[model samples]
Structure formats: C-alpha cells, structure tokens
Target chain A: MNAPQRIVVDPVTRIEGHLRIEAETDASGKITRASSAGTMVRGIEIILRGRDPRDAWAFAQRICGVCTLVHGMASIRSVEDALHRAIPSYSIPRNAEIIRNLMIGAQYVHDHVMHFYHLHALDWVDVVSALKADPKATSSLAQSISNYSKSSPGYFADVQKKVKTFVEQGQLGIFANAYWGHPAYKLPPEANLMAVAHYLEALAWQRDVVKLHAIFGGKNPHPNFVVGGTPSAISVHSSSGAAKARGGQDGTAVNMVGLQTVQTVIKQMKDFVDQVYIPDLLAIASFYKDWGAIGSSGGNYLSFGDMPEKDIWTPDSFLIPRGVILDGDISKVHPINMDDDNEIQEFVSHAWYKYKDGDDKGLHPWKGETEFNYTGPKPPYEQLDVDQKYSWLKSPRWKGKPMEVGPLARALIMYATGNKQMKELVDYTLKTLDVPVAALFSTLGRTAARGLESKVIADAMQGMFDSLIANIKAGDVKTFNEQYWDPASWPKSMKGVGLMEAPRGGLSHWMVIEDGRIDNYQAIVPSTWNAGPRDTAGNSGPYEASLQHNHVLHDPKQPLEILRTIHSYDPCLACAVHVTDPEGEELIQVKVK
Target chain B: MSLEDIRVVVDAGESSPYQADALSGNAPVLLRELAEHVRQLMAAGEPTAIDLNALPLTPADLDWLKATLGEGEISVTLHSDGESTLAETACPGVWWVTHHNESGHVVSRFIEVAFVPELVKAHPEDVKTGLEYLESLIFDLS
Candidate 1:
C-alpha cells in the first residue's frame, strides 16, 4: 500500500487574513487528516493592557480591515457592560439600541455580499470561461433567474468585452492565480458569465449600501462606536441655513437627506440581495450540489447571539437567540452562559502560546493570557511540526468540546428553535436544490446559510429603521446617554464580557477594568472560534475538522477543493492575531523539507 | 401665541428651501469627467486612467463622487509584492484603483477608465514562465 501524501496550501487567499492548511491524504486523493494554523501572533490583547477602556474600541477595531465595525461594537459593548455592572441604574436609550441594530444589520449584509461575490465565488466561478459565453444567452439566463435590472444583452455584451479585454491583454488581474478550467468547475459558460457580471455588480452595490454605516457611525471602515450609545445625533431641525453661513459643510446630524440616503441604501441592499446575491448563490449552489457532502465538522454549532431587543445583557431579547447544538441534534439546544467559567475556555496545548497555569489547561477569557511562544520551526522551513505547537491561535472550546460557529450554526440553531423565517428560508433553499436537511451541515450549506441570513438581516433592517423613525416621531431623538461616560462613575474593579454575533460568527470581547483602565483585555473573536488549532483533548477546530472526510484533491498543486472548504468558513486571521511582522510578509512559510 | 403658530415656527426651522436646492449642487464636476471617460472606453476601447490624488477633492466632493459614479461590477485586492485594490464604479467602464505600501497605507490612487484596471492583469513575463512551468510539470507527470 502507498503511504499517505501531504498537501500544504500556505497563505490561503480570498479570506480576510492569513491562514495555512496542511492535509494528509491517501494515494486515492481523499483527505484523511488536516491541520489548520494561524501563522501570525496577534498581540493586540497585550497592547491593550493599561489603556482606558473607553478608547479600547478604536484600537480593537483595527484588528481586521474586513470586519472593522464588529470589533468596535464588541469593544464598546464590553465597556458599556462593565459600566452597567458598575452602575446598575444605567441603561441605553431605545434610540441608541435601534441605531446599533441598523449598524450591525448593515455589517452583516455588506460583509455577506462581499464574502459571497468578492471572496468565495471565484472558488466556484471560472472567469476565463466567462469570456466564452454568449452575452445574449447570459442575459437571458440572468433574467430567467431574477428580475435584476442589469440583465440587458447590451449590458452583458459590454461586461463580456471588459472581461475579454482583460483576457486578451493576458492580464487576469484579480482573476490571476485562479484554477480556471479545473475539472471541479461545473458552471456553464453562460452561468459563469452571469455570476461574473453580478460579481462586478456586487462590488459597486456594496459601496453604496455601506454608506448607511457612514451616515450613522461616521465612516464605513471602523465606524465610531460610543460605549453608551451611537455617536450620531438625530437632527429634527435643518442645519442647512447654518451650514451655508459657515461654508457648506454638512451638519453632524441625521437630517432628512441623511435619512433618505439611508432609506435609498436599504432599498438598494434589498434589491441587490434579492435580485443579484440570492439568485447568484442558488444558481452557483445548483452547480456545486456535490459540495453538500464535502465539509461537515461534526454538526456541533455555537452562537453567542446578537441584535438585542431591549438590552444586550438580556439573552432572551436577542434576535438570533444564544444556544448550543451538539452532534447535529437540532431537537435539543443547550443554553450558553458566557459568564460561567466552565462554559467557554481557550486551550493553548496545540497552539504556540503558554498559559499561566499550564500549557494544557484551558483559561476563560476573563483570565485569558496572550503570551507569544514560537516553539515551531524557524521561517523558510517546510511542513509544520503538527505534533507540537503549530498555530498562533488558541483552541477555544465550549463545554470541553470544539464547536463550529458562523452562519451554519446560527441557521441550524434558528431552524431547530422554530424560527419561522429561518425555517422557511432553509426549507425553501433545500427544497430548491432537492437536498436533505442534513445537507445543511456541509461547506456548500455553510455558504448558502450566509446568503440566506443576509436576506433575513436585510429585511429586518427596515423594521429597525421604521422603529427608529417612530421613536423620532415620538420626540425620542436622543442618541447618547452621558451618564456613564465619566471614568469616575465606573467601579474600581470590574470585568464584563461584550458578546455579539459578528458577520463571521459569535464574537466576544472580555475586559477587566482597574481604575477605569483596561487591566487585562482579551477578545475571543469569531474567526478564532472557527479557525483555531486543536485543543488539549486533540479535537480539531472547525477549519481542520471540516477539511476531513471525502474532500478529494484532483491536483495537489491547485488544491481548489481545499480552498472551497476553507473559504466557506470565511477565515479572518487578522481578528485572531492583531500583529503583523514589520515586512508584512507571507503569513504561511511552506517548506517541503 | 396659538399652538398652530408654534408648530409653523418649528417646521420652518426643520425645512429649508435653499437647503433642498443646495443638495443638488453638492454633486461634483468629476462625475461629468468620469462619464466622459466611460464613453471613451466604450467607443474606442482605449483605457483612460485618472489620478485622483492630483485632483482637489474635499470630503464632500469624495462623497459626491462615490454617490455619482456608484460602484460597478467588480472590486479586487491584489497582494503581490505590495497590496493594490481596484474597484469598478456603477459606470461599467470606469474603475477606481488604489495602490498600498507594505504598511497598508495608500501610496497612490487612480480612477482608471477601462474594461479592467491594468494592475489586475497578469504580467506577460510571469505568464511566459508559468506556461513553461506547467508544460514541465505535465512532462514530468507523464
């Protein structure tokens, strides 16, 4: 019998941050085992020590450019949670709550659209093949799928020309390094062209849609998030006359123009998702239906829950309820307690870092430590020493078990807990593809769930906006509560966890405040939960576990199948480790020694 | 004063006639230039690149530009030796391209009016070597 061979994909592209995957496969090309490693040490937690808790959001938001606002939201929520603990009488206003929901909802929609088209679509799409498609046929095919306004033959012809020019010029720019014409690619030429066209559409669509965040939170990337409430003030009266007198600078308020722009952006989001994103996903999923069996991570799912109804502290008020589903059993959901020391813990046994107590012992985020321990081989070496410390990411465990997080977990939990909308969406998608409920547990299912949830969140944004407008009509225009902004009002010693369902998955920022300054701050981000290394119990993380089973590699050099599985998780190594080397070199150094 | 009179005063403050007209004026002249560039690309298939850094753009002007041009079909981030991003505007042929240094700072920004940005194209030299490498691999495997 032939020995198993190893295939390594260093610096996995299209995702938010740096990641490397090493898989050992039999001669038959089926993966037997896999190791997921976050190659960079993010020492943001270490740098955060002794800083004012109020300013932590600004620093923490810089963790990842892709998931910019989520970290800021989590950071501010952590400070607010601590403040609320200090002042039990403190509460965020309804207006503030509504605005935060809009911001979060916008992030989910924007991130999901960007992820599907810009990042993950190429894994399925063949850009070179799109050039071969008949523009008229592509237009007809696009129109047959949805009522998207951009489905003119002339429009498609222009897009085809643009793509053709790129191909003829022998420059595939972003389309470079693609596994074009690979056996795994199954989309018809016309379908590929339609997807390619929408892929271009989504890029433009996202820029406009994200302006909602800028209107409400100041800027798109790493928007301003105040601890008590949003930074935006609702302007009931026009500052136009005043602005003109002081030179045409727009006022810092949610005026009629701002409100209308938000409305326009929301409509645009709905139109694009309904017309372009969802249809493109379904169309693409139809082609890659076989991927439904590829990447299943034991069906254990976890969600910290996000988008609160009344207060963030109250778990029952969450839009996506917090719970745990173990072993793919949807009938029963175990309640998640973020405060319990036994509920959530990070293990560094398989990771490079060492804990204060022991390398094998798991520590809760409240007592989490970020100690850099590079015990692996030096740079420019080959395969990782997987038997020892491999990744920079600490293995995070819920109840001593590795669980998958993100859209799949959220969708499964929502479906199991009898969320009507989620059930309808999942049922419709599965029925359309003629796949079973079990199919929702694989890589394609994970990607599909992301698309489905974007629609759910985008539709929900209207309700949130309406509620905000209703509040304004009732003369409740206040956006910030200044009661807890002062440091003197905070408790001398306090620790609190700010939990939210970021676009990727469940994210939490745990902070210990001493004299109103952060003593020890640790952020257990979503990507860490999904992409961390194996735990003390030797349980592989979601990324590693998902790559197991029948993920067969046709070509070891291309490794397109591996990319499909990893990109489905939308790995964001930037959120896990906040530090990059001075040279900003490749995170994964693949050596074949 | 009557309650109706008080309501009227408040309404007057909130709604300004000049403000409504001035909002339209906020649109930048670059939008016209960008449109012309797109027309050029469509007619002649000749790529036109505009350096946005050279243009005097205020924050308001930038916002207007974003709104006016809108985002088009594709946005790409290329990480070779350094990071560069190219995004197409709603105008099919117009594109926004930015080059970043190693530290993730934008060194130069351009609005390239073409079917696709030049930076996204594969270098001819690299393609030549890539083809050779592929042929060699095929030969070795066979």
Candidate 2:
C-alpha cells in the first residue's frame, strides 16, 4: 500500500466565484478523501442588520455578480412576505406575477446557456486542437448533428481562422490558462470547432438576451426591482400620435418593441438550446460516458420550488415543486418545510464562524449568525487545517444530512415527484446518451440536467410572455402594489423566508423585520449548500463528498478530473463569502498566540 | 389680423422643426468606423483600439453599437486596484474593455480589434517575479 497523496486546487476557475478543493488519493491515483473550502468571508448578512427592510434587496443583490438578480428577487420576496404577514390584503397583480415569471424564466435560460457554453464546455471541448479541424468536415459534422443556421463551410473556416490567429498571437484570452490538450479532453477536432463556434455565438446571443432584463428591470447585472412588483410600467403614450392612438402597445416601457425583443430573445434561447447546447451536451457526454460512474455526493437532494404559476405562497402552483429525495430513490419525495427549524439548519463546526450556543449546534436561517472566527493557518499556507475550521462557508444541512443541491437535485426531485416534463427530458437525455438512470447521480448527469432545465425553462418563457402581454392588452397594467410601500402600516416585528430556485440551485433569504428595519438577515445561497464545508458530525459537504471515491487523476498538476467534478456543481463561492478589500491588501492579520 | 389670432394647429408635445432637427443628430459615424475597423482586422489581422470615452456618444448610440457589433467568445474580469471587464464582440477580434473605479463607476471604456486586449495581459515583470519565486521555493524545498 502506498501513502496517500494530497492535491489542492485553489481558486477553481470557470465557475462564478472563489473555491478551493483538496483531495487525497490512494496508490492507483483514485481519490480517497476530499475537502472543500470557501476562502472568503461574505458579511453581507451582518451588513444588512438594522437597515431599511426595503433596501435589503439592493444590498443582497450585490452578493454575487453572476447570479445577480436571484438574490435581489429573494430579498424582496422576504420583505414582501414579512409585509404580507402584517397585511394579508397585500398581493401582486397578475401582470406583475407574469412579468416576474418572465424575468425568472429569462434568467434561467440565460444563466444555463452561459454555464453550458462558457463555463462547462471547455471541460470537454479542446480549443487548441480545434485549429487542426477541417472546416468542411466541421461543418458536415455540425450539420449531421443539428441543422443550426451557422453550420456552413465558410462560417467554420472563418471561426478556424479566428482561432488560429488567437493561437499564433500567443494570447488565447479567456481560453488562456486552461489545461488544453489534456487527456481528459475527449471531443474530436471537428466537434471542438463546432462547439467553439457556438460558444462565440452564445456570447453574442447572451448580450442581446440580457437586454430583456435591461428593458424590464433597467439594467442587466443587478437590475432594479421593487418589493411589491417590477419597476417597469407599461408605456401609455408615445411621441407619434398614431402610435399613441394604437393604445401605446407599440411604445416603450415593455411595449411592442420591448415585447418583440423579448420574443426574439426567447426564440434565440430556444433555437440555441435545441440546436447547439443540447446537441453539444449529448455529443460531449457520449464521448465521456465512463464519467457516469463518478462524482456522486451524499444521495440526498433538496429543492425550494420557484416560478409560482398563481401565488408565491401556494406550493401547488410552483412550476418546479419543492421536495427532498433521499437515498437516490426515484420513487418517493419527502416534503420540505421551510418554517421548521429542525428540518433546515446550518452548523459551523467545520466553518470559520461561531455560534452563540455552540459550534456543534445547527441554527435555522431565521436565527442564523455570521460571527467570524478564523482559526486556520495564515495566508501563503500550503494546505488547509482540515481537522479544524477550514472554510468560511457554514455547513448547511437538510434534516441533519449534507444534502446536495442544484440541477441534479432539482431534476431528481421533479422526476421522483412525477413532473411529466422533467421526467420526459431526463428519460430522453438518458436514452440519447445510452446511459442508465443511475448515471443521473454522476457528474455528467448533473451537467446534462442543467442543459435540460434550460430547454424546459426556455420553452416555458413563451407562455409567460403571452400571459403577460394578454394582461397588458386587457388594460391591466398594474406593475406595483403601493399599499405596502409605506412602512407606517407595519407590525412591530415579523420574520419571513424568501425561497427561490436559482439557476444553480435552491436559494433562500431569511429576514426578521422590526419596526420597518431589518433586524437580521441570512441568505443560504446555492453555493453555500453545495460548496460548504463539513458538518458537526464531520460529514463532508457536496463538493467534498462528490470528489470522493474512484476519481483517478491523470495529472495531479492539471487536476482536470477534479475540476470536472467540482465545476459540475457550478461552485459560486462569491455568493457564499463576498467581501472586498480595496487596498490590494489582505484584510486578515492573525496573531499566533 | 394679428399673428396670435392666426394660430397654426400643432400636436401636443410636438417640438418645433428646429428643435426636432437638433434632437435628431447625425448618423452613428463612430459605429461605421468601428465596423470598418473590425472588417480591416478580420481581413488583414491588423489591430485597432478605439477609446469610447473620447467619442461623442449618447447612451442610445452605445446600445446601437453593441447590438450591431455583437459579443464574441470571451469575457474576462480583472480585480486589482479596481475592477475591469473585457468582452469580445461577435466580430471575432473586436473587444470591449470597461474599467471601473473603486466606487464602481466606469472610468475608462475602449473598443479594441485585436487578438486580445492589452490590459488583460499579465505584466511581464510580474511573470518574471512569479518565475523567480517558484525557483526560490524549489531551491528551499531541495
């Protein structure tokens, strides 16, 4: 027996934020144990204390640059819930509901597309080798796969030229610093070129699509949103008399032009998902079918449902129902209770935080605390002191177990709960990949589930837009309910939980409002659930446990295998622990006593 | 009859001809220039950098330029001193680089048609220092 070797990948790239993964491998290079750590401490929750409850959205929205609007939406929902509890008559109009759904749908589509092409594609596609592909052959291969519009010999030739120029200049830009030509890269040169082309196309597509957010919410990253409803009001007047005579349907403020742009964006999203993203995912998955055997975390999954069809409070109206699936069972889904402290709790034993009672105890988000207690070795250390507090992220456990959250969790829960759409998508994808249902528990399955969910959401956006337009045409243009706007009509104290399914996974924000000011705020973001450290029982979190058992690294230096596993979770540590130190200096100054 | 008595009918909120003309500015000449620059770069591998801050551009014009040029394969974020983001337009080599100050305000914006924007490149001195540090570490370990 050989001594176990330890490998560390600090600052894992291509995903949203900062994350570090340390793994110990046995003699044959199979990973035996692993630990995940979030290196930064996000004190946004602490900053939210004593602030105006209405302004919580603005501050929480800044938590993550990638999942920008999700936090804001969750924050507002939390405040809105608290207010609604005070005044039961408060409710958003149908138009507002439809628009919110549209925005959420757009976010899912845009985020999922970006993740597949920009973040996750490079894991499978080899860029350098694409330069060697024959443009004619690449076009033929693309056509054979899907009848996408850009699959032409001339188009591919142009893409190849651009790649060659980038290579010759010795500046791959975003493609730089990648483990290109690695043994883990399984796509053929032609497939690689095709994916690279779509990748560029998606970049352009996303810029246009994000204009939907801008048109409706005033900006793309961290868009404006009011507590009662969206900030966008239907335009009722225009410079042209004829346009105005047409009842302002063709004017600004989410009018004809805006709706048309949204429609175009939706079509583009659907077309790309169907033609480029799905085909690319299947082709890439086919090449790496053996990966189906690796990267399964603790077999429990959790999802907080999102995109309410009628009312946000009604779980039955949720498009993606909330439930927990245990032991990889597709037969039963246990119901999740957000209000139950015993059901959802966060522990800080393996994290760099302390609890008032004890580190071993788990506290619910409503009662969660963000007390920093960094006990790890100082900066420039080789590895973390894993036996003690290693990560800034608290261990978020569902029913005292380190449950995995994200697309896999959402898909499995949906499938187990008999969601016809999800079941069909999952079954078709498994059939196409020629992998078993058990493959859904692996890393490739997680990646494929993201693409599938994007398709499902993209297709659903059309219905949301139609309903929103119907409401607008029927002269129902109420975008905000101002009854709850004034804080004077509030109770002395109230607590509420705002939960939503972010593109990465389930996201929830808990807030306690007292006299119209935020008493306490805690956000259990998707990354915190997936990229958290160990629990009080010393059980590894999703990122750690997923990397355990039989992940054989070809080269520990590159560690592309480890990255493939970690990136499958789409780790966004920025949302988990975001703090900016402006002086280009380290904020922590620990004195060894 | 006085001029006031002989009133001409006009639409409400409608501007005078001169005011309307003033509002309707010239065509986006800079967008034309940008497109031409991109074409030149694609045809002959030559690089061009246009400083957007120096140009007389309205928000509408900027939106037009972005929509026309489209986005490309790569977007990068640099977090040092302040934050800067560089994204390529659909026109392969055309890149848009925006630098934000500490207060999260846009300080500089540039559109460069090149293999990659220069600001995104690692400093040569820093690279040398990194190599030296790695060597020192190896020596100490040995």
Candidate 3:
C-alpha cells in the first residue's frame, strides 16, 4: 500500500480563469480530501456601490470575458426588476424579449462548442497520438460518425500537415505545458485526429456565430446593453431602401440584411450543432464510458430558468424551467423563492470573508457582505490551512445544503419538469450511449449535458428568429419600454434580483437601489455555486465533492483526472471571486529608483 | 435605454464612437515580452511565439504597436488554407504573422521571435512528398 500523498495543480490550464486545486489521496491512490480555491479576487460589486442603477450593466459586464453578455443581461434585468417593483406594468417590448432570447441561445451554442473542443477535449484526446494516425483512416472515421463535408482525406491530410509543422517547429504555442500522452487519455489515434480537426473547425465556426450578437447588440464581447431592453431597435425599411439616405442604417439597425444575416447565423449554428458538435461529443464520450460512474456531486441541483417568451417576470413562458432536485430523487422538485432569505444563503466559514456580525451564519445575497479577511499562508508558499480560511469564494447553499449548478443541473431540472423537447433529447442520448439514468449524475454526464442542451438551444434559436420576424411584420417595432424609464418615477428604496440561466449555469444578480442609485449589489454567479468551498456545516462544493468521489489518480504528478472533472464544470474564477473589504488604502505600492 | 441619456464619456479625435485610454494599452507589456523572447532566443537558442489574437488588445494598442515596431525588409505571403502574411518587424528576429480564413476573416495573429517564421518554412515531409510528385511526373514523361 502506498502512503498518503498530497498533490496540487496550481493555475489549472485551459480554463477560463485562475484556479488552484489541492487534493490528498489515500494508500490506494483514491482521492481522500480535496479543496478548491479561486486565487484571484474581483470586486465588481463594490465598484457599483454608488453608481446609477441604469448604468450598472456596463461595469458589471466586465466580470467575465468568455461569458461576456450574461452579466450585462443580468444587470439590466436587475434594474428592470427594481423598477417593476414600484410600477407593476413595467416590461420590455415583446420583440426585445425575443431578441434577448436569440442572443442568449447563440451564446449557449457558441460557448459550449468552444468549451468542448478547446477547453475540455484535451482531457480525453491525445494530440501527440493523433500524429500516428493515417489521414484516410481518420477521414473514414469522421465520415462514419457524421456527414460533415469537411471530413475528406485531402482535407484531413492538410490538417495533419499543419499539425506536423507546428510540432516540428518546437513551439507549441497554446498546446505547451499540457499533459500530452498521459495514461488516462483513452481515445484512439483516429478519433484524436478527427477531434483535432474539429477543434480547428470550431475556432473558425465560433467567429461567424458571434455575429448574431454583433447584429443585435452592436458588438461581440461585452456588447452594448441597456436597462429597459436590448440596445438596438428594429428598422422596418431595408438598408438599401430609402432609409439609406437617413444615415446608412445597414448593420446599425435591425433591417432586412441584418435579419437575413441573423437567419444565416441561426442556420450555421443549428447545422454545426447537429452535424459536428453532437457527433464529436458522442464519439469522444463512447470511448470513456467508465467515467459514467465517477464524479457525482451528491445529486443536488438548482436552476433559475431563463429565456422568457412573453413577460420578463413570468416563468410560464420560459424555455428553460427552474426547480431544485435533492438527494438524486427525480420524483420531487422543490420550488425556489428568490425573495426568501431562508431558502438561498451564502456562508463564509471556510472562505476568506467575514460578516459584520458573524462569519458562521449564512446571509442571503441581498444582505451578503464583501469583507475580506485573509488568514492563510502568505504568497509564495505551500499548502493552504484548509481548516481555517482557504478560498475567496463564499459557500452558497439552499436551505443549508450545498447544491450543484450548471448544465447538468439545468438538464435534470428540465427533465424533471417533463419538458417535451428536453425529454426527447435526453432519451435519445441515453439510448445512444447505453448509459443508465444514474449516469447523468457524473462528470461525463455534465459534459454530455452541455452538448445536449446546446443542441436544444441551437434548435430553439430558429423559433426565436421566426417569432422576431413575425412580430416585425405585425408592425411592432418597439424594443424599449419608457413607462418606468424616468428615475423621477419615485421609489425611495427598492430591492430586486435578476435571475438567468447563463451559459455555464444559473446566474443571479441582487441589487438594492435607492434614489435611482445602486446601494448594494451582489452577484452569485454559476462558478460560485459550483466551485465554492465548504460551508459551516462541513459540506463540500460540487468541485471538491466531485473530485473526492470515486476519483483515482494514475500519476499524482500529472493530475489529468482532476482536470477532467474541474474542466467539466467550465469553471470561471474571475466571475466567482467578488469579495473585497476595501481598507481605504492601497494593497500594493511600487517604488521607482 | 434612451439614447439621449447615454453620455459619451470620452470625446476625442477618434472617428469611431468607442474610445479607450491610450495610456492603458497592452503595448508596454507586449514590448517587454518581445524583449524577453529576443533575449531568450539569443542566449539559449530557443524560439518562442506569442498569439496576439489571444491577447486583449484594443485597436489603439494595435496601432501603437504597429507604429512602434516598424517594418523590416522582407515580407512574404503564403496562399495555403487561405492567405497568410508574415512580415518582419523593424526589430530583427521579430516577425508579425496573420492568418486569414477562406472568407478573408483574420483567424489568428501572432508575433514570432525567431530567425524565420516557421509557417514560411517547408517541412521535410512536405518536401519529400514534393520530390515523390516530381519523380511521378518524370515517369509520366517516360
């Protein structure tokens, strides 16, 4: 038997942001204890302490670079929800809702595809082994899987030449420092080659799909957003028509050409998801089927559903249903109340934060404080004192229980809600993979759920586009609502929570507005729910729990199994660590000689 | 949501509406990186490349970089898998490379600190394949 060993993978590669994972293994090489730490601290909430609620979206959207528009959307919804509290009839135009839906749906398709290929695929596919594969055999394998036309022998040969050139050059730019040829990588050489080809294809595929956001919001990353509705308005006349004389309203406004571009992007998104993304996902997943029994996080899920078709506040018209499933029971789903402080609360016992009164008690987001108290080791040191303060993320729980939130949670919630489309897609995937229902609770299940929901969202984009077109033809060109737009509409004090299903998971922004200015703002993002540390009751987060359950590291030095589970959540730490005490002094000072 | 209430914070000589502070650009960090890579290449005979597309550079930062690192003598363009351009910066051993897809959209951009950009070089296997093709052509002639 081996002695107990400890391993740390600091600054996990191929992730959206900075993270550090420390795990201890027993004599059998099975993980015994684990701790997830978000090393960076971002205090965007503190920045919005006194700004106008209407302008919060601009500053809030900078929280993340990958999930660019989600924070902005949530901020806008927060302001609108605050105003709607004073005036009941306040809502954005129906076309605005549809346009937002189209943008969010495009985000899901684009972000998920990029995650699968660029971020998570290296965990399973061995790039060095791909060099040993024959191009013709790789082509045959790709053709057998899906009818993607780019899978020709000549095309694969060209890709192979480029990869060979890159490898020979001895500078593997992005592919450097990876655990290549690790024993845990299970895919065959041909599958690796085919996946490598699609990896490059997805890089190009993402470039065009984001044009949908540019068309609607006027940019891609951190696109222009507004409080009342979407940024752009509809122009009934075509860009080349008489409207051209009034100031060249081509891409600036939603005209015929813009609508046509949107439709084309929709087609491109759906086609790629159907032909390329899903096939590659299923193919790669089939090779690692044993992962079905690994990395389950206690089977507790939560989702604040998004994509409203009619009213912004109503959940009946939402495409994704919201609910909670506990203890792996699909029969009973507990409803969530955002206003109920007792339901959803965050604890900082195992975190580096302290409440004004007590660090042990859980506070809801509306009352959540951001006071940092670092008691761990100083910089350039080994091993955090895990029993004391460890991570920068607060432990968020529902009714004193840590819950998993992300694609897997959303899928389970939708399936438990008896959603017809989701049910059909889930059933088809289960049958195709020959995995039991319990498989949906594991690491591979989380990855497959992302692809499965990407398909659903990509297909749903067409319906959203059709609805937008029909509404335009019906002479409804309104995109904003001005009923409560004026700050003088007089609500001395108001509080609101903007909830949405971001690409990663359930994201909610809580705001307390006073005199048209933001008093307090707190965002409990998806990664905070998924990658948070232990709570006062000694409960582990999804990231820690998943790593501790049935996880065996073949080589402790190269923790590829840890990367597989962590990357499966698509952890974004820049959006997770928002605690800052602000001591009214500079934390660092530089001196010049 | 109203356009009138949205104030333009920085009004300058820029044509586009989006304005950013020139002082807060990525040019300085990138310059330091280029200097480090050049030093490494000289001392250890090691080559390094930085993917510019991966960096968060505003247009102002790019313009500043282009003006600072002027062009050198040699410029080459390869027309394979779309059009790619590799041009040497005024600081020798530093090259600017850009890869465009078939639609002419820039897929990737990089700065390579090396003697010659690797993409411009012909791999040995490709040269061997070329030799085989030329031999087959001679056989056809016979």
Best by lDDT: 3
Please state the error at residue A489 of candidate 1 in Å.
Answer: 1.9
The list of candidate 3 runs beyond 4 A from truth reads A238-240, A243-251, A580-593, B1-142
Every model's TM-score: 0.80, 0.79, 0.81
Lowest summed-lDDT stretch of 10 residues in model 1 chain A?
A578-587
How would you encode candidate 1's per-residue C-alpha lDDT over A199-256 as one tens digit per residue? 8888888888878888888887878888888888776443344433323334453665
- Which digits, one per residue and each the tens of the lDDT, describe model 2 over residues B1-142? 1111211122255742223233324326766787798788779978889988887754445555666678888999999768999999887778888898764547998889888787778899999999999999999999
Q: What is the lDDT of residue A340 in candidate 2?
A: 89
- C-alpha positional error of residue A152 in candidate 3 after TM-score superposition, expressed in Å: 0.9
> Ranking by DockQ, best first?
1, 3, 2
Docking class of 2: incorrect
| Candidate 2 lDDT tens digits, A1-593 | 44568999987888776788888998877888899988876577777788888888999998887888899999999988887777787788777878888888888888888888888788888999899999999989889989898899999999999989889998778778789989888788999998899899999888877878887898898888988888887753334434333333432457555666677777888898889888888888899999888998868888998889987888899888899888898798898888888989998898877677889999988877756677888777898988888888888899898888888898888888888988999999888888888899989889989988888888888888877766655557788888868777788899888889988899989889888888888888898888888899988888888898458888777899998888888878878773211222223554533
Predicted candidate 3 versus true structure: per-residue lDDT over B1-142, tens digit per residue = 1121212222234333212443346677899999999999999978899998788875456656766899999999999889999999999999998898886557998899999888888999999999999999999999
| Docking model 1 quality class | incorrect
